[model samples]
Target: MAKLIVSKFGGTSMGDAECMLRSSEVAFGRGASLVVVSATSGTTNDLIALGKASESQPWAEAEKILSKIHSRHVKIAADLHLPTESMQRLETLFEEMGSIAKGINLLKDCSVKAMDTLMSLGERMSSVLCTEAMAQVLKRHNSDKKAMWFDVREVLRTDDSFGKARPLTKEVESLSQKKLGFLRDYKTVVVTQGYIGSTEEGMTTTLGRGGSDYSAAILAEGVAADVLEIWTDVAGIATTDPRICPAAKPIDEISFKEASELATFGAKVLHPATLLPAIRKNIPVFVGSSFDADAKGTWIRKEVEDHPLIRAMAMRKKQILVTLSTPEMLHAHGFLFQIFKIFNDHKVSIDAITTSEISVSVTLDDSTLVNKKLIADLSEIADVQVEENLTLISLIGNNINHTPGLAKQIFETISDINVRMICLGASKHNFCFLVSEDQSTQAIQRLHKKFVEA
Candidate 1:
């Protein structure tokens, strides 16, 4: 039996007609049975802007963005030379978007549900265009079979978390068996949207920003795919962001654990949650550049032959460090518990933590969204200090904590830079710390040179 491969193309890969055509060739050429696509580059952001405008601005303001969305899709269709039927469908979808915007304007409310629905449009439209483009390419290549645009909302079931929903794994598996189980029987390519899923009640919900990668992982596990390929803009996982360090080198392969650490800490190659499903299924995951389809890219799997001491480094910027000091915390048993309870109640996630006898400091992402309220609540118990514009630098590999000289090497490399916080021994794959945002690039370069270049 031919193995079913699930390939996901990121937004940049689907950005324009030319990009979509290139992506189609990859999908068709690779014989990917299932292709999940994100919104064209910038489309999701534009949709989000439209959602915001609809909530507070007049219909005119919303209409401006609506027009942009419509015109963009129309141009893509014209560029793709879509059939008249496909062109009419694109028009209808645009009209529906306009109606949605008008409805939000009339209601003066952009509820989470409404936002989800609005955001889903980008992927919906992209999937349609991608499927049609792939079908046309297959015809051009003399293949009789056509690509099918699949509405994955029907197969991926999730809870009602609205913007950041969680997929019900069993439900997804059951539905995939019923809906997509027959893909093996036919020589057809299935194209579907990423990031968006439906609740059991059929309400639209997104998996969150960068959730498209998560969507692909879930679908890969659900359909028992032999391989899951994540096609994005870069050459794949690198020692450090190439933009940050020109010397950053691509890692040919990495373990699932190391990749997870990189994604969680700061790497943008894959959504943090994308590896969970693949890890469970023990599927071989490939990260490749859609733009450079021939590049070797990176492979992520259960285990790789060689385990380097420090495989890569990732930096997460725009971090906020919150330090809470209370005299009462000294020798108090429940002091730590109290701090954690506040976080749980407010649903604020901490990225890293450190503690002294009377003080505890933690780092958080999306601080702008959670800091003010969290600080207000936390202040009731301790004196709070918030520092913004920090960055978390992480060294990812095997036994990094136990590896001799690694700690000294990292600190020595950045000895000139102020080290705000150091977190170690939490994960075998990572040794992370906090530094000023301004010094992040220097830190990455110095560390990459010491470990990767050396």
Candidate 2:
């Protein structure tokens, strides 16, 4: 068995022709490797827009957008020195994508089915192009130019859940081994698509937000890869979002548990759910800067020690805080239960929540589908208000069961800020607070200063 590494190249790595070439160089530079690639920068978003626009109004504009997309990819292929045959093939794929977009426009309502089919074009095109480019580079180096680009739609099986498809884990796990075994038949590299999988019925599906990272993790876990490198635009995982805290430094390593906490809260580096499959397989994931691949990156392991009480931070902005107040909830069995049932039925997840003697407040993503039926039921005895224009900032660390008056210190640090509400997690390692959107950056900087920096 050959040692394998699955490098999950982010959008920045495959952003354009130059980025794609540089990534090809890094592949051989970093040693024996397989690669998973996301779409070129902004491709997925463009596809999503095309879908929405087509749904509302399928117009001639779809053709204009399609032409624009085709020109970009064709230009990139030309710049990359891809063989004429490969360039033509890449163009054909884009044409197919364009066709789908136009179909959505004509349909005047892009179904989840159509959206999944459309969104996948981003990764599919990138991998195909990157594979061709890598093949040319390897040929120049006297290395084998026989890399096979596997379409994930053929193997990555999942449910028919439309946009957010859940994989048939056991099925995929078995298939992964089989596929890798077949892929290893060639001594060259294997380039695969990220962020897109297929349903049992052979329809395209996505793993929700950050699906590309999740795709990488699943592939790594499936192959038992020695390393799963997540190459992005940044150096690595930072102590805090530098955009919010300029002093934030890159972390060299993090435990899976810690990484999970940070990702879930707001690290914004890895998809929060991306770590689960990796953790289950005890796979080590590396987060590194694509622009500077030589730098020491962050490593995530299954079990770890020596984490800071305030290791890293994150935030979910533009959240809605819902407060339900009623005397009926106090000492009334199943009152709060019914409220949650409503939320559960609607599929809106609660991030942080607090309960009082007569009221229950929860922070959610403000999905439009929150059921009116549940609201009507709650209205029978409770008052409800949806508070928008708020942000929830959280600090995730390890063994924070007690933080030496951390609550008091946090309040004192950002006391002048507009503090709307706060909730410390039961584990005590994480403390979350609500504040005005305008003060979010300042509040984060303040907490970063007094607590983290000297």
Model 2, residue 410: what's the lDDT?
Answer: 78
Reference-based lDDT, residue 155, model 1: 96
Taking all chains together, each candidate's TM-score versus the true structure is: 0.97, 0.94
Best by lDDT: 1
lDDT of each: 0.90, 0.80
10 residues in a row with least lDDT, candidate 2 = 366-375
Off by over 4 Å in 2: 183-186, 367-381
What are the RMSDs of all candidates, in order?
A: 1.5, 2.2
Model 2: per-residue Cα lDDT over 298-330, one tens digit each: 888876666777877788887878889987766
Angstrom error at residue 73, model 2: 0.4
Residue pairs of candidate 2 with colliding backbone atoms: 58-105
Quote model 1's TM-score.
0.97
lDDT (Cα, tens digit) per residue for candidate 1, span 1-454: 6788999999999988999999999988788989999998999999999998998997789889988988888888888888877777677778878888888988999889999989999999998898888987898899866688889999999999898999999999999999999877657899999999999889989999999999999999999999999999898898888887888888999999999999999998989999999999999999999999899999999989989999999999999888999989888899889989999987778899999999999999855445567778889999998888899999998988777887887898889999999999989999999999999988899888898998
Residue 251, model 2: Cα distance from true site in angstroms = 1.0
